[model samples]
Target: MSLGRYVGRRLAITVPVLVGVTALTFSFVHLLPGDAVDAIVGFRDVSAETEAAIRAEYHLDQPVWDQYLLWLRDAITLEFGESPVTGRDVSATIGRRLPATLALGGAAWLLALAIGIPAGIVTAVSAGKPADEVGRLAALAGIATPNFWLGLILLFVFSVRLGWFRVLPPDAPLVSLATVKFLVLPTITLGTAAAALVMRLLRSSMRRELDAPYVTAARARGLPERTVILKHVLRNAFLPVVTVAGLQLAFLVDGAVVVEGIFSWPGMGRLLVRSILRRDYPVIQAIVLVIGIAIVLANLLVDIIYAILDPRIRY
Candidate 1:
């Protein structure tokens, strides 16, 4: 199929997936222990009429199916209603916090690629040596470590003992050095596991490519070792790494929730945790829908990249 046709087909497939995400999110969020009204009036004595009015105002009094239909209708237009707890437009709130999350995720992604690709190349070239063994062990440890624990350890060591960075992230604009300084620990914490995964996969891919007949032909032609590896083996081995990096977007989102919370970063992940706790239905639903859309778009981008990298790949 043509690229346009393929993209259109994939996007069409996403529509129902998105709808299911909305329906499931709405149902599960409502099934939580308390409504927004209860969160708003917590531990306070209110008249029965006042409580009933609050429920009616927020449409919490509606049946679950009715609420889902109403929400789905507005959501189709990208009109997530106001947060019952904060009374702010859900889109505007998410817009404000989105940049921080993007910045964090982007930095972590770059760091992962920078570290992983080179490490993978080194390990593959030096297979069965001490360097490869050490790299493998380090990757295993990185994958095993928890994000929150790593964040705390980095915070304690760098921020508290060494005095290298702050315990809490600064309130600075995204482009500034202050923001970069603040992001260092959280980015490392969030990206380490992903980096490890990429390294292992790439190493394996490259090793397989190195043993291929074409690589043997290139070597027998008296090409330089560096040229044979870089110009031939690495290119073929890179496709799987691209696939993993695309899927890591979802992992980054999930890890950001804990990493942001640990560092007290004011991003959508932190907002999500807070909203869930307070039963902020609109905010919760909107954030989840946005995340779903992001994952779909990432997968689409991955498919496009696959075709670009390997012309043999078909729609």
Candidate 2:
């Protein structure tokens, strides 16, 4: 299929997928045995008038499908509604927190790419013993370990023991060096996982490409090893790697929820936890929709990147 046609089809499919996400997320959040108001009142009694008022405020009295339609309508218009938990506009709430998550996620992905690709390259070049074993070990540790444990270990070693950074100070400004210090542990935790993934993908792809007929012909024709690898191998090897990194980047938004909670970092992941605890349906639904859109956009971006890297795809 032509690139334009492929992109158009993908965009068209996104509409129904987003509607499904909004409806499914809405239904699940509400079906958890309580409404937003009930979660807020904390098992306390409420007057009939108060109950009615709360229901009216959120349009909770409306039918399930109608409520979903209303939320969907507002989302399409970019008005994500208000958070009953905080009385803040949901869109505003997300906008404020989004950058921090993106920053952390970007840092993680960059670090992973920087470290993993080099290790993969080296391991591919030195395929037999020492380098191969070391690279495999690093990848194994990164992949086998859980993020939360890594985060805690980092926190204990760096923050509590060394006095290098806090577990996130509530009053400190985010732009300051102190906040950056606080982000280090969580970033490492997230990056390590991503690094493992990148290394495996790059190594596997490079290994396969090295064995391709074009690479063998180049080597036979007396082309420099570096030129053969760089000119002919890395491009195809990295196409899928780019897409994987993009998908992983999206996870960095919400996947760090546990790490953010552990370190008390002020990011979307932390905000998601708060929204979940309060049973803030609108906030949760909005966040879910935004994440869905981000993933779709990321995949689209990957497709573009692939086309750029492999010109044969242009047609």
Candidate 3:
């Protein structure tokens, strides 16, 4: 089968999976115990007339299934309704906040690539040396430190005593891109574990590839050590690396919440978290659905990329 058909097949599977996710998310969020009006108003003395008006205003008196269909339809048209807390369009709120998350996620991805690949290569080459030990220790630290704890430590040390950066200076204007600077600490915190995982995966894969029959044959046939390692070993080794990286990106979406909150970086993770705390079903379901779709789409894209990278892969 061809790449096009393979991609189509992936999409065919992803669409229904996303629909199921959306439906489940909607149902469960609304199922959470409490009156939506009381949850929003925080008053025990809400009048029946006021409650009825609120229900009519948001069309909440409709059947749960009807409410879901209405919401799904509006979402398809990019409407997304208004936030109960802020009284702003949900889509608009997400639009305003998305760039902040992307900025952090992007920074984290670059940092992971920069630190991980070279460390993996060096560790693989150095096998049992001091460099390899250092690489192992770095990975250990990265793996052990939770993002929330790491962020707090960094904030305490760097922002508190050392005065390197402030604790997320009050929502700066979105135009200047200074938000990148604010998000740096959180990004590094978030990416540390990912970088470490990638390093280990690559290091192990590279070590195995270097010792494989083909590499041994190439070396026996007069290939330089450097050429054999770089040209032959690393290339084949990267197929697994690509898979790991794609999985890391998917994990990053949900995993970003702790870092997002610590840094006050506006993103879907933060939005979902806040919505859950407030029991805001619409916002929660919407964000969860978006995240689910994004992960499936990303995996599909990765598979397509794999085919493009090596045409030996067939549908």
Q: Per-residue alpha-carbon lDDT of model 2 for 29-110, expressed as tens digits? A: 6777866678656567999898889789778898888888887788888797777678899988888788878877787888
Where is model 2 more than 4 Å wrong at Cα?
1-5, 29-57, 60-66, 169-172, 311-315
lDDT value, candidate 3, whole model: 0.79
For each candidate, how many residue pairs have backbone atoms clashing (under 3 Å)? 0, 0, 0
Per-residue lDDT tens digits for candidate 1, residues 1-315, read 676676677778878877787787678766767655666676477899999998887687988789889878888787887886889999888887888888898889988999899999999999999999999999999999998999999999998999999888777778889888989999999889888989999999999999999999998999999999998999899999998899877545533888888888888888988998877777887888778777776887788778777777765
Top-scoring candidate (lDDT)? 1
Q: Write model 3 residue lDDT over 52-87, tens digit each, in one string.
A: 998898788999889889877887886777777777
What's the best-to-worst order under lDDT?
A: 1, 2, 3
Better of 2 and 3 by lDDT: 2
Model 2 residue 71 lDDT?
A: 70
Compared to the true structure, candidate 2 yields what TM-score?
0.84
Clashing pairs in 1: none
- What's every prediction's RMSD, in angstroms? 3.3, 3.1, 3.1
Candidate 1, residue 151: the lDDT equals: 93
TM-score list, all predictions: 0.83, 0.84, 0.84
- C-alpha local distance difference test of each model: 0.84, 0.80, 0.79
Candidate 3 clash pair list: none
TM-score head-to-head 1 vs 3, winner: 3
The candidate with the higher lDDT, 1 or 3, is 1
